[model samples]
Target: MAEHPAYPVGLRLTGRRVVVLGGGQVAQRRLPALIAAGADVLLVSPEATPSVEAMADAGEITWARRRYADGDLADAWYALIATSDPEANAAASAEAERHRVWCVRSDDADAATAWTPATGHSEGVTIAVLTTHAKGRDPRHTAAVRDAVVEGLRDGTLVAPHHRTRTPGVALVGGGPGDPDLITVRGRRLLAEADVVIADRLGPRDLLAELPPHVEVIDAAKIPYGRYMAQEAINNALIEHAKQGKSVVRLKGGDPYVFGRGMEELQALAEAGIPCTVVPGVSSSVSVPGAAGIPVTHRGVAHEFTVVSGHVAPDDERSLVDWPALARLTGTLVILMGVDKIGKIAETLVAHGKSPDTPVALVQEGTTAAQRRVDATLATVAEAVRTHEVRPPAVIVVGEVVTVGPREPE
Candidate 1:
């Protein structure tokens, strides 16, 4: 006899009963979807994984501490039998069948009335793939298909309806450190829709290679220096492109507000009557140090971390930094664009009463494949920076917090 093909449907389980007859890995995987669907989940198990226990403790789900009884499925609209014991799963499936509730059996889908599909989501769209007609019900094929589809959505090869509408305006998007994967979903989507992208040298370079040929990419760092189009040129380019009814994206690195000069661009656009949007990106000050296994703050070591721009030398007449006050701070100090002036900055701190032996760390090209870490003290960091040839676009951390927290990458 030919088997009946399973029907596909999206169940609205909001505030409804959904019983899960296991607390192992399978239950852990399926529970999230059920809870996300707003199901009143009741989990039955003798013992559960720590994560499942934590969920129950958090009141996200109701846990039945004992084994499943025959009438456990009497009121369940849907039940999933994922217990390790074959007999327990079979018994639970039989009970669900008797109560006319749809049952999904992890051990034997052939005997169950429903099958879970491989699922992925992007930009308000949910994708589910089920190879119902495939012999032996291979999940690998469905998962592979789901992954390909989701990757396309993320990289802009596939576009969802909500993201298809590209309005003519400027979007200042922070691309995050250097890792392409670190770019926010919204930022990536906007990058795909951009007709012109004015990008910083530190922005995610890998993503630029994947953009469509029609998108004009301008390297902000290479913008003609000393020409009228330098800073003004960049500003004029944004305003001109937006006025021409083109979607322009000023792709920057790190959080736009974190010394990224994003406000300057925003003000330029506003004065020109060009509408603009700002999409925040993860800042390197915290994330870069975190990538190198250093915490900016530790409970007992340090409570505060200050981020400062070290582009200008401490003794430079145009400098605004209060070196004396910065030297007195007891917490962590993070300096950006300070590699060249690190020698002077170090001397200034020490001259202002900062201990010469204070621990310090320099993270170069953080969160990317070229990530390198060098450790020293206030007195020795200058020599270490020179010896390591630590370049610009690096983060400098000073304080006891450099030695606190996780020392090794997990």
Candidate 2:
């Protein structure tokens, strides 16, 4: 008769005795999962990798500083034999068999009674893929299939059927510097459940395309040159939508609070008596510079970095920026939305005692595939801007820290 397939089941190993053989890479890889499953893991090895040693020191697992003995599996619920020596693994497996404990063999899967599956988790869902460990079976094919499913779920393409509770509220989500994958797990989950998404120009646009057909996406970019909308209009839209019992997500690029006008919207929601939540995003003020290999702060170079808006010129009567004070600071200065007024800003800094030869770096469309950097000194930056025809949404860095990183290309 042909051999029967092994039974598949999820083990409730919580607080149960589990023996893990070896102290190498394979054992290191399996130990975390066992600990997560609440297994009372007993690791047997004369020596262990640094990571395993650290875990033992942290009291996450018990380390038995000796080779696997016959009594190690006496009352164990399960055993994982991953020793480098095949003889040692076989001996552990033999002892587990005598105690009626199922064993998973890393070296010789066919010799073991159980097999570990490739696993992934997303949005409270755990996915595990298993393939027959019989002589002719391939594990790679199963793993590839598992990865595809997980990616689909993450990107919102492959969704499980369920009714999403549409509690009317507002969420300020920071869409990290243009990468769809950079959005936080909570931000993505809340977005998936949204009825309305008020999106800005800098947030991840690709993620918007992944939303269900019923999700109402509103373009919130309303500056004079950009697709414009007034702040009051945006506030009204959010209030109106939430009042109609719709879940609203105000998604902006970088962080919602870092010059994102997020507080204005939140205050408006609060006045309207609507529940609101803010989900912080990775701010581009730091991430964008780092992406271009520009460290805003380096040891023995810059002790602090200042982020300011350059939407208005330093000479503009409406401008709130203290140009004289900023010029006097001996640290890195970062300016956002300043491409249009960079010439005046540079001139003002130069006039205020900031060195004309101070290095500056202009990063455009930062943290995206279209990112490009224009390097110049404070005196020549205005001329370079005109030559490059640099546009808005670029970050300008000044001070010595601009030249602290890798050499810029000519």
- Winning model by TM-score: 2
Could you tell me which residue pairs clash in candidate 2?
222-228, 222-229
- Residue pairs clashing, model 1: 229-233
- Relative to the unseen true structure, what is the C-alpha lDDT of residue 70 in candidate 2, on a scale of 0 to 100? 76
lDDT of 2 by residue, 1-410 (tens): 01666566889999999888899899888899899999999899999999999989999889999987778999899999988887888888888888899999989888888888888887677788877547566788878988988877764557664476656899999999887888887788778878899999889998999899999999976523334358878888889899999899998998999989999999999999999999999888898899888999999989999999999999899999999999999989999889989999999999999999999999988878788899999999999999998876788999898888895574
Per-residue alpha-carbon lDDT of candidate 1 for residues 1-410, written as tens digits (9 for 90 to 100): 11556677889999999999989999889888998999999999998999899989999999999898889999999999998889888888888888999999999877787889899998677889986653467799889999999887876767553445556899999999888998887899889888999999999999999888899999987777575856687888889989998999999999888999899899999999989999999899999999998899989888998999999999999988898899999999999999999989999999999999999899999999989888889999989988878887899999998887555441
lDDT of each: 0.89, 0.87
Q: How far is candidate 1 from the true structure (C-alpha RMSD, Å)?
A: 4.9
Worst lDDT 10-window in candidate 1? 157-166
